[model samples]
Target: MRFFEYQDRARRRLTLLLGLFALVVVLMVALLNILLLYTLVEPWQELRRLMPTAEMLAEHRGFLLWTTGLAIAVIAGASLGRLYQLRRSGGGRGIAREMGGDPVDAEPEDPKNRRLRNIVEEMAIASGLPVPAIFVLERELGINAFAAGFTPHDAAIAVTRGAIESLNRQELKAVVAHEFGHIRAGDMRLNTQLVGILFGIEMIALLGLGMLPGRRARSDPGEMRGPVWFNFALVAAGGIGLIGGRLIRAAIAREQEYRADAHAVQFTRNGDGMAGALRKVAARYAGLNASPAMVGHMLFANGAIDQLLDTHPPLEKRLERLGQPLDEEGLERLGREATDRVRRAVTERERRRREQEAAAEQRREEEENGPLGEAFGAVPGSLAAALLAALPGELARSARNPHWVADLVLYLILHPDPEIREQQLHMILETRGPESEERVRQLRAMVPEPAAEHRLPLTEMAFPALARLSRDEQRTLAGLVERLIHADGRLSATEYALGRMLIEHLDRRHGHGGKTTHGRKDPAGKNARHRENAARYLLATLALHGHPDDLEAAEAALIAGLGRFTGSLPFSAPIPEELRQASQSAAWARILDRALERLARMPRHDRQRLLQAMDDTVQQRGDPTAEQRELVRMMAASLHLNVPLPDAGELFDAGH
Candidate 1:
């Protein structure tokens, strides 16, 4: 099924869970009634027969009322206990965070924490969803994890630190991707519902225990007569209810884990990553698949191992389903191997990142200035004419999409000389008419055309202005134009200089002193104010690049760059039709924040490359929107500089 289809299925499953709960409740009531008739009330009947009088009959009725009340109290109390468990467990990190814990610093510095953060960002890009918040489980040695959230928008993925250190890149990717798949597929919603239902089922067992005490609190009544009628009645109900709830949990938990594993395999496109992970678990602790305490059936691997009466099928069986023969390797070997592969993956990733960074810096140094009068000369006249020819058809279709054109206009305002944008603005104002002749006449000078209108105007207006952001944010902001050419990884010298020049113009417009720290005259580390302003300028410049000049988006980006470290949150413009479109959301923002946190101390070139990569991804989807552009800009700004700065609004129209 498509992702949305799975989402729908999950929703339906939620209803199904409710149905099951209702069914169980009915069964419990019926069972209680039958037991009460046969046991507690039966003794009353016998006593009444012995007394042979009206007063005895009345006493018998009173005894029956008390027995029913006791049953109700037991059931209700159990229900309450289960609720209490859920309440206490809210926003929980399960066992991982509790054991491994967080470091003392405001920003995370732990290696394991860093790895987990990186994996989540990588997986998010791979799967094309907003990065969800990532969490770590430190103490768990054997492999296990779980994705928890109320919805995809608010979801979090938590993994064991052992799992982080153990799994290879692909395996780790496969694991994180698997959890993302659960989120994208809406499985988390259903899983949460299942938890609630299971709680309800357990409530019955609680009721049984609660009533057991009622049967015993009969000191006066016991002396008058054997209180077996009340005592045994309470015990029976409690025992039955508790047993039923446990059975339901076992039934629900096992299947979902298997399904989640399949999803992991599907996402990574490598059966080995997930299948290998399971093998590692078995070998690590002699088939110890114990779920964490109080987290039964909740972990990625079985927190508690219960093979015989457990919900999960055997690991070998799960592997065989993936077409892998598990018997070939011993379990411990697989575990260690999987763990080692993940570490190597992390190292290689860091290496490639460094190279990309170095490459970007080299380009920036070569062409250290923005294009002058002749830069537009680089454009071929034919391509410009062709753009003119296609403008009308392209314009009419997307003009109504609300978010479509606005981002591009914002981008233009950011890039190019202020005068260039003002003239483009004049064109926009002049060509507001609908007539083809009027449009053609206006377009005559702009392009060598039978004439362009919205399309040509929009493109010419958008790209150059957006190039004002740091190269990465510029690349991302250009996401506004559907077919706009974009270069990824390292920026060309021309692109680098173009970005620097635009920032210069912005400084003038915003009333900041021009190039306060620049050139050979001002060596590095000479000016603290310059350093502070420079960092803040870069953060604002990067974040506001493609944003629609909005306060909230700009503020968010600034905070991300210099704010406290937190889980990955989605930060892209909310696509109206969430289930259908693949777009950024608060979930992905968390991943982007982690990326920024890691690179916070890095130089601009590396920061630019990663941010651009995000933009490249959005455009690769065929046509990037304004919302996407804004998000990328914000991310680029926030990277590696979680330092506080003025609000995004104080900087530009984006802040406004």
Candidate 2:
């Protein structure tokens, strides 16, 4: 449906809700009238009877009492029907069942619906987003998908089984990416709120119905004559409330679909693929709709959005809104066009990225000898390779819990103090730790005997033991350790320290030096010198963030940062020239800011690093110092820009 059509429908629904609220007020009034008759007229009738004026009193009260009671009873019957609709339109269980997912995570899994899970993972990697929960609809043949969740971390995407089997990888990616667009753009929050408000609109009518019985029960016997008039107004009010709410929810949610569709196109750079996917579903309309009642407001296209009844724009119109051709012959063209268009787009994007990387390399070389250079940019190439290699494997696997790998990151970072190393060794010696003799034997059995550790330190042995697991298993295990370290809020200091250490150790054990020359520039090139300078500047900025008060601590931070990055890409693996530089600058800048902000917030500590950065700054430039220059370097990296060298006067002054 066209996005605006959904917006219009939601407005209409809200209007309906307002109308229904008025009806509920009227019904409530009718119920109140019945009670008033009992409390006022019926008692007065009895009073008149004792005074021998019964006939006069009875005639006055009878019509009004019966009228009020009748109005409430009629409204009750009509309101019950809306409740059934309330259940259906809510899309609560129908959606859950279709997705083969339980609203509650503890529900047993259905073995038949695993495809939904796999598609979500692939799309997430392609789009550079974390994976979302996937659900399957066993009974649905409709090619429909929706993204839902309160937050990105908890978001869910559900598609029918037909969607998976019917669409190829690209189309599936298009659809999933569309859903993520909704997730990213904050449409899901708006969507969830619509559901909540619809429920609130119903609450008033339900309360009105609940009050009806009590009104009837307490009426005085034979006191007031029934006047059916009051009850008539009551019933009219309730009907308006029910229909009004359905329109409101449908209206608000429908409009975002177009935005989501366009976002999917942007995300995949394949308009025709997304358009074609929609076109294919529209062509198969006969078998592609859920029950109108089940998908009423939740679907991409309404099941019942016939020209006359639907709140959404008609299907042909929606396709046109996306500039897609309606016929089958055109769909094939769109498919090929989309593929080529995306390939070209990807190539261009990669090219722009490479150029940026090359420039960053030059900047790094220029900044390397600057006061802050060494602390700034430098990641080992091997770690970058591992990250790239990990991506394909991570995407292809089923039963992914990347969080498990994330958790193990802390373990991988394990470079414990000597005491901690000894403790690790003793734990291994106890024959209880997993790194003990038996595990070593198992490792020897699995790998070449030459590669097995017979006399290595326990710290060294622990990592290879982990790497021997099947790739997926290793990810899972690493993810577990990471989880433990970061269990609450941020990872504990000890955890962070250890995780980095272990990461370095593992890289070493695998004969993988984190350093690589993939994106390094030629030595004689001017750009090469600039790139070297940028790395040095990046390190200095990071070293400052570590609150290094002396050369020793500053040097340590430089080592850690260099060790962490060095010859590798800051984030991704297989460093392109443009990305490596941009990454080096971007990462160095971010970590610098983050680290500095962390230290800045802490109470003044007399730690060696703290004293080091302080005294070192004072010594470099006397008195007020070039702290401002350092600040500029720190901030420049944060903005992903190289700080042009200022003259000596700009950096330091002896005026004081």
lDDT: which candidate is best? 1
For model 1, what is the alpha-carbon lDDT of residue 346? 60
Q: Which ten residues in a row have the lowest lDDT in candidate 2?
A: 370-379
lDDT of 2 by residue, 47-145 (tens): 334332456436756655665555545444444454444434323334445545433121112222333443444344333333455565534555667
TM-score of each: 0.46, 0.43
List candidate 2 stretches off by more than 4 Å: 1-118, 126-128, 209-238, 286-296, 306-313, 328-656
lDDT value, candidate 2, whole model: 0.41
Mark the 10 consecutive residues where model 1 has the least summed lDDT: 370-379
The lDDT of each candidate is: 0.43, 0.41
Candidate 2 lDDT at 55 equals 64
lDDT of 2 at 403: 20
